[model samples]
Target: NREPQLELLKNFQKELTNYKENLEKVEDVDSYKKDVSFPKICKTNDDKRKHLAELFEKELRDKFREHSPTKTIYTRTNQI
Candidate 1:
């Protein structure tokens, strides 16, 4: 009968409510945005590319250098 379907819907609603409550309890929702600080002035396309490259290199070094010292790190940029 429809009784099983009704019960399933009720359970789904309860779980959705619990999920919303947990999401609202999160304090640092935008904390990821605060982690990276980008340069304010990128006058030309080359400047922007250089800044992004430096940022990528710094992130890679910070994350993987300790784990793999012997591994070589390489970065490539696409030509426009």
Candidate 2:
């Protein structure tokens, strides 16, 4: 129901942020090739993206926990 919808929203947000960050880094690399000596913008972008991904994952996990703890909670079976 709402659980899946919320999850999708969270994922969308995460991907959107990543895309934005990457685009910015690409532009920076192209524009500031001499001014900014970062060796490789792609590398920096990848590192940033990794950190962002981790942060986003934690945030989404926490949100899911608060909103739908049942999503991850496993139950034991009891036979009569």
Best by TM-score: 2
Top candidate (lDDT): 2
lDDT of 2 by residue, 1-80 (tens): 58785776677677767755665566443353343334343476555445445555666655655565464452222121
* Cα lDDT tens digits for candidate 1, 1-80: 55654565565556555644554555543342356454767655445445545555555444443344333442222122
Instruction: Return the TM-score for each candidate structure.
Output: 0.36, 0.38
Q: What's the alpha carbon RMSD for model 2?
A: 9.2
Q: What are the clashing pairs of model 2? A: none
